[model samples]
Structures are given as C-alpha cells and as structure tokens.
Target: MARVSQEHLEARRRQIIQGAARCFSRDGFHGTSMQDIFRETGLSAGAVYRYFPGKEAIIAALANEVLTAVRGAFDDALAGPRPAWPDEIIAEALRRVDDVLLFPPALVIQVWSETFRDPRLAGILHGALIGMADAWAKVVASYQENGLMSADVPPAHVARVLLACAQGFLVQRALLGPLEVQVMSDGLRGLMSMGLRRPPEEEPGADAS
Candidate 1:
C-alpha cells in the first residue's frame, strides 16, 4: 500500500471537517451523530475515522481552525508599518469572523453549545482567548501611544474588553443575522470613535464638540 502524502492527508481532513461543519451547523451538537457526519462527507465510516477519531475530535479541529484565524487577524492588525485605528483593527477581526461564519453562521452556536459539556474544548478556547488577548494588548498599546485611547486603562484590560465585545458580536451576529451584524458593526465603530475623540485637555486649543 502506498502511504498517503501529508498534503493529501491534510486535504482529506479538511474535506471531512468542511462536511462536518455543514452537519453541525444544521443540527445542534447533541442532535448531530457520527453517522450524520459520515453521510455529510459521503465518506465511509473508516475513512472518516482515519482523520478524526470521533465527533469530539472533529469539533475540536473546527474550533482550532477558528482560533488560529482569529489570532492571525489580530497579528495582521498590528503588523503594518503604522498602527491601525480601532475601527481598522475591529474591521480586520470581524473579517476573520465572517470568513469562518461562511461554513455556516450557526456553526459557532453549536460549538458554544458543546463547550458546556466538553472540558477539553473549553480549555482550548480559554487558551486561545488568552493568546488572542495578549495580541490585542499590543494593538491597544499602539492606540494609546497614538493618543487614540485613554492611558488610564491598562492595555490588558482594554484587550479583555475588546475581546469580550468581539465574542459577543460573534454570537449576536450569528443569532440576529447580517442586518444586526451591520448594526453591531456600526455600534462598535461609534463606540470606538468615541474613544478616539481627544479630551480638551489633550487637544490644544480645540473647540468643544
């Protein structure tokens, strides 16, 4: 038997994961079964198991993919030669969220549902969020240096707040649909714009708004 190339193996795993994403998006985690995933992928049971031992492993793969993408967005937000504005950072992060939501917007709801029962998955999320928060802290510090954000709040605290908002936006956008996402996006922009407005003390000879 010819051993499979690593590229082929990874492609097969992604194919199964994409199909499983469709299933989980339609059915809640409890409602979804391995058989459903097998059917969704149109792959034999043995083929599916070759990539993922069980449904839990499949879900973990999806979650990790999401975490990696979100972390990459934060990295991009800070990689430019100049610091990005708050809206720029949020927009980039939201773009990553939108990319994952493509598989099915409802998929995140299913993932969140399973976290209540899955400690390992929950730990994965906790660690991902910590890493994400640490990256955001750099963005926050950049904003402070640019005088776009207040200096009183610690960068870590600001990162936590932005992360909470982003996570909340993900759930709410998934639940309420794109119209609400547009509204939430506008709201976030407005709030961030408020932060960028310089205080009179900081603005030299500025007229009161």
Candidate 2:
C-alpha cells in the first residue's frame, strides 16, 4: 500500500497525458492502443486506467484540455486593458486566432470524425462550441455597444460565422496541400478590419452614383 501524495498523483496523470499526446500525434487515435500508451508513459495498465477509463475517454479529456486553453486565451484578450482603437482589438483577435491554429489540426479532425458516431462525444464537442460562441457573442455585443464593432450585425450570428470560417479554412488547408496559414490569417485580419470599420463620410456623393 503506497500512499501517493496529491502532487505525485497529478504529476503521474500529466505524464500519462503527455504520453498519450505523443502516441496520438505519431500514430493517431485509431492506431494507438492502451499498451502503446503504457509503454510511452512507462506506467502500469492499471495505473493508467485508474486515471482514464479508455481510449475514447483519453481523447475526450485531451479535447477538453485544448478547448479550455483556447477559451482562456480569448477571455484574457477580451479582459485586457481597453485598446486605443477598434482595429487594435481586431488585430489582437486575429493574432489569437492564428495562435489557436498552432495546435495540430489533426486533433480537431479526430474529434469531429468520432462525434458523428458517438452521441456522448458529439455532445461534448457541441457544448464546447456553443459555450465559446456565447462568450464571444457577449464580447462582440459589448464592443458594438461601444461603437467598436458593427452594431448592425447580430453578435451571436457573427460569432458563429467567424468560427465556421476559421474551421472551414483549417479543414480546407488540411485537404489542400497545407496552404499558407499565415497569409490566410492576414487576409482574414484584413477582412475583419474592412467589415468592422465604418467608412468616412463622402462629400455630397462626389457626383458619383
């Protein structure tokens, strides 16, 4: 009977997660096995099972971990000191979006592919998306009220559209030969600026239709 300190328990769990990440990144979720994780972590099967029920559980945990970090990063940007201008905030937002893409796209593809067949998994992914969108919508709505964003656009709809666009961009890149992510990201930043910025008033339409 060994009494493990809480710190040691957490360390062991983190070790398992690291091992799982390596295995999944190298071999993918379907290709990985419990024994592979055991070998990677140098942990007994029982010990690993004590922390996670199975492979699916491990994947779910990993997705949650990634999504939580992303949400936290966005919240931090929104809660930062007020920007001098709307473009500043929009630039920061685009930079954050690029940062989110730093993670391997395969991880997201794995989760979504599994979700179609697993109701529990689907629920987890759906809930995360909804929560993220809701939080973003609230922030966008606040900015709109402050005249930092377009008030005509519905916050929730804009949030959803942004997320959909980001996801689509990644998926397309994954399928289409690793398109230049940075260039695409910059273009999206420009698009955000163009849409959110109000044009300067013209003098008597300048005799143009």
Q: Provide C-alpha RMSD values for all models, in order.
A: 4.9, 5.5
- Per-residue lDDT for 13-112 in model 2, tens only? 7788768877886798889999999999999999999999888887787667766765765577577775223234334444554454344556667767
Candidate 2 segments whose C-alpha is farther than 4 A from its true place: 1-3, 83-104, 172-185, 195-209
* TM per candidate: 0.84, 0.75
lDDT of each candidate versus the true structure: 0.80, 0.71
Tens digit per residue, CA lDDT, model 1, 1-209: 99989999888888898888888778877778999998888999999998899989989989998888888877777888888765566666777767765576668877877888999999998899889889989888988898877787799998898888777877776787754445556777787665355566778666656
Best by lDDT: 1
Query: What local lDDT score does residue 188 receive in model 2, on the 0 to 100 scale?
Result: 65
Clashing pairs in 2: none
lDDT of 1: 0.80
How many residue pairs clash (N, CA or C atoms closer than 3 angstroms) in each of the candidate models, in the order given? 0, 0
Candidate 1 segments exceeding 4 Å error: 1-3, 180-185, 195-209
